[model samples]
Structures are given as structure tokens and as C-alpha cells.
Target: RPATVDYMSVDAEAAEVEIFRDFPFADFDISVISVEVQAHNYYELDTIFVTAGYAKLAVLGGDHVYAKLRRPLVPPQGAAEWQRTIARDFHAHAPARSEIGRSQ
Candidate 1:
């Protein structure tokens, strides 16, 4: 079995916490996690992830994005530049556009 998971997108239907509790994340390098969580359960999720050395990067609708930043929640240098790069990449590869127009 693959113990190292770099990214996990979990939509366990409110059983996310239960599922996560069983995994030994400390044994591997988990870079990003996107989990389905109820709005009311944000606090619970926050505590669990924070204790596990992750920072909540964003909360999109019912999903939350968490990343292990090696430190507290402060943004790293050139945060705006990173955001712009991400946005550009997302737009360049958007599904509505044709592959012929996408940058390599």
C-alpha cells in the first residue's frame, strides 16, 4: 500500500474526521488536503489540522484547503505573485478553452 500521499481530496460525507483520524500523516509528507466539511464544523476541523501542522489556506463553499506551511499562518514572501501565477495557470488550462490555445 502507498503510505505517502501528497494530496488528498476527501468527500467522506461528514465522516472526514473519522477517516483522517485513522491515517498516520506524520509518517509521510502530505502537502495539500481538500476536505468536505460542514460550515458548523470548521472549528473542529481547524483544531485538528492546526495540531497536525497545517494551515487553512482557504474555505471554498463547503470545502476547505489546508497546507503544511512549516510554520504559522503568515503568508510567505511574494504571496501576491504566487496568487497571480496560480490564477494564470488556472485560467490558461480552464476546461472551456481549447487545448490548441493553451500554453505549454
Candidate 2:
């Protein structure tokens, strides 16, 4: 029943995928998410987030994957313009390659 979560971090040991599956991605406005996953569960976790309209931002320390929502979240009145500006700036400054520790 949570409405908006700006960021979420999950380190659920072996239950990372399950926890992500249970999260209401469509019902809530989650801007960013990071999960600690084992090698066996990495694909499954990636699938869930990609299916939920998120794009992989980075893979940290091999096990932690970070993602951001593909689309912009609705902003409060008087903040929409500011949000758009920030988004533009972010995209401009974002890394050329999303993932880390990967051969270019």
C-alpha cells in the first residue's frame, strides 16, 4: 500500500527475487531500485525489473544491480518543470555505458 518510493534497496539474501516480485511496481512510483542477488538469480531479477519498465543502471561489486525507472514519475504541481530539467541534466551526465566492470 505504499504510494511512492524514491529509492529501494533489497539485500534479502536468497529471497531477493521473491521480494522484488512481491513489490507493487505498477502501483507505486519507484524511481530507483537496487538488489543484491546471487549469480543463479541474476537473470530472473533482471527480467522482473525490465518487465516492470525499469532499465539497468549499473551492476555493483558483481552482486548488486541498480536500475532506474524507464519513464518519468508524475511530479507535484510547480515541480514538473524542475523535474524535467533534472531529468535532462541527468541523461546528459549519465555514463556512456550503464554497467560497470564490463568490457567495452
Candidate 3:
């Protein structure tokens, strides 16, 4: 088994939710997941992802993309601590200000 999975795309037709449920989330630090969902199992899939600390990013065609709610830290920190770290990092790397010009 690999140490971590950066991305995973699943198209299991009617069995997508079943396959996703069987995935080993505890064993892998999965950053992104894309799963094809049908109306019958959309809620189940969403619940599974949300419970696993993932948030829906987008829906491309029939595939729903989910990203990790909190990026895994090396030392394994708490969620609140991780959020603070991310906010600090974002501000540190982001531009101080932005200028938008409109053309008439």
C-alpha cells in the first residue's frame, strides 16, 4: 500500500457508494476524491465523505469532487490548530492588497 493517495477517481456505476464505503480512509491520507453518484445514493456518498472530514468541491458531469476539510500536518495536530496554521500560512503568502480595474 502507498503511504498516501493524492487523488482518487471512481466510476463504479451503481456500486460507487459501496466501493467508497469500503475504502480505507484510516489507512490513507487522501487529499481529493471524485466519485460518480446517482440520485439513489448521492446522500449516502455525501454523508460518507463529510464524516471523513471532506467537503464537496465541485460537480463535473456526474462526478462529485471532494477535498479534505483540513490538510494533514506532519505532527498530527488538532483541527482548530490546523485551521489556524492554514490561515496564518495563507496570509503570509497572500498579497497584501489587490487592485481591480474595469474597462468601459
Candidate 4:
């Protein structure tokens, strides 16, 4: 049967691009992906991820993290979304902005 992936971690050495191409990202909503990329061709892999609606979040050593922006995660959502949520919640709780920052 087919399955949905919330996260995927791939360490394909030099075959990272080939491995990534095997997945049909168009059919599923993948939340996050971590792939081990080679210094010489990580950009190619990044282009593929970008075409699939993923954004490069970070790079640690040889591993890179990509998040599918079309569907965002909660609790620890993306920084931009988190900021919006914080502002909205604050405004709902305190409409007036006092010297302390919260609205009276």
C-alpha cells in the first residue's frame, strides 16, 4: 500500500539525487526531509527539492534539511508562521499596546 511521510532521512553517499528521484513527492505531503549531499552537487539536489515545494532550512556538515512549505507544522511551526501566530495571539489577548508592549 501507499504511505504518507512526515519525515525522511536519506544518506545515499554519492547517489543522493538518484535516491530522491525515486520518490513521488507529488502524491504525498512530506513535512520534512534530511538528505546527505555531496559538496560538488548539493545545488542540483536543492533545485530538485525547490521544484517540489521544499525550502532549505539548514545545513549541518553534509546533511541538509528541507521543509515542505505548502503544508506547515504547528507547535514548532516555521519561523515566519510562528512569528505571525505570536503576534495574532498577543493581539487577541491584549489589543492595546502599553509601555510594557502589550496593549491596555
Candidate 5:
């Protein structure tokens, strides 16, 4: 099912409180950090492409995740394979674009 959806940001403090209160087990077992970085460009690609790129970096970056940068790749290559190579190369530098911003 697909429909137009409106999006909003949740208060991070409230979200944390709720998660801890309702799912205490989850909190103790988990560490979650959310970051909002600005990519001032339109991304017109499949969800798989978008998500795989981020996840690969998150896992490989080892610490500084959430992508201070992202790179675009064309297809016929496997997502995981490309992501591995990208994570290695990407770690050295931040995203270089026309303009970039970071939002908490």
C-alpha cells in the first residue's frame, strides 16, 4: 500500500524516555544514535540503494557512522560489494558536494 504521507520529527528526549519506559529490556541491550545530516539534493533512486549505502557505512565506519557523507554509484554491481569498497574509500573524507550541512 502506498499513499502520500506527511513527515515530522519526534522530540528526541521524549522518544528516548518512551523507549526506555516501555521497552526497558531493549534499552539495556541497545545503543541507538540518530543523526540528521543535510544532503541538499534530490535523491531519485530505489529505497534499497539508498538504505544499503547508509547501512554499509554504519557497519564499516566502526564508530563515526550516520554518514557525514554519501556517494552515489550506478548499477549492475551488487549493493553489498560496492558498499564495502565505498566504506574503505569514504572514511578518509567527508561528503564533498556543491554544499552540505549537518542538522541534529
Candidate 6:
């Protein structure tokens, strides 16, 4: 049951996620938990885009799997604002950068 689902750890899987740091995204104490309960399932973590920390994931499967963002999704926003938000996060907490570096 638990195996059917998956989670992205953020730092571990940054490159694969579609995000921007220029904007702003609030972080949650707990990671977004995605689940899978399908009777039968087949998936490859590599084939799919997943991050270890705060990245969005794309799982290959049917309704059997369910996903919930432990970190709530940001409210809708304009394109430029959204891009900045993603870029900011990516630049700051991206697996590559240090948390301190982002605040600047």
C-alpha cells in the first residue's frame, strides 16, 4: 500500500521539478505525501520526474495512486510572479544551493 505511493525529498530531486525561485512559495514542516492504492501498479522513479525535497512529481500510473501536497500549493498568480516565485525557491533551497544563500 505505502509502496504504491511516492514522495519527492526536494533537495534530492530539484533539476527534474518545474519550479521558480524568483517568486515565493511557503514551505511546510511536513513534505507533501502522495499515495497509491491501485489494485495493480507499475512505475519507474527514473522515467518519472521526482525530487527528494520540495519538487513536484509526475507518477506514471492509474487512479490506484493518490497524491497530496504536504506543502499546500500556492494560490494562483500571474505568469511573471509565478516564475519569480519558482526561481526564488529553486535558487535558494535548490539541492545545489545553501539555504542561507537564498535569503540574499
lDDT (Cα, tens digit) per residue for candidate 1, span 36-99: 9976677888888887779899989899999977664434666687788889999877777456
Off by over 4 Å in 1: 1-4, 72-104
lDDT (10s digit) by residue, model 3, range 5-104:
8998888878987887877787888889998899799899998888777889999988999998774322276677878888999988875465335334
**Candidate 3 pairs with clashing backbones:** none
Clashing pairs in 5: none
Cα RMSDs of all predictions? 9.9, 10.1, 6.4, 8.4, 15.1, 14.7
User: Model 4 over residues 14-68: C-alpha lDDT tens digits?
Assistant: 8988877656887777888999899987888998888677899999889999998
Show where candidate 2 strays beyond 4 Å: 70-104
* Span of ten consecutive residues with least summed lDDT in model 1: 70-79
What TM-score does model 1 achieve against the real structure?
A: 0.60
TM-score of each model, paired residue for residue: 0.60, 0.59, 0.63, 0.61, 0.23, 0.23
lDDT of 5 by residue, 1-104 (tens): 32322322223432333332343221221122332222321131113223433321342222212221234443458778778878988865766564357554
Model 4 segments more than 4 A misplaced: 71-104
Candidate 6 weakest lDDT stretch, 10 residues: 16-25
TM-score rank order: 3, 4, 1, 2, 6, 5
Candidate 3 lDDT score relative to the true structure? 0.82
**Count of backbone collisions within predicted model 5:** 0
Give the Å shift of residue 77 in candidate 4.
26
Q: What's the lDDT for residue 36 in model 5?
A: 27
lDDT of each: 0.80, 0.75, 0.82, 0.81, 0.34, 0.37
- Clashing residue pairs for model 2: none
User: In TM-score terms, which candidate is top?
Assistant: 3
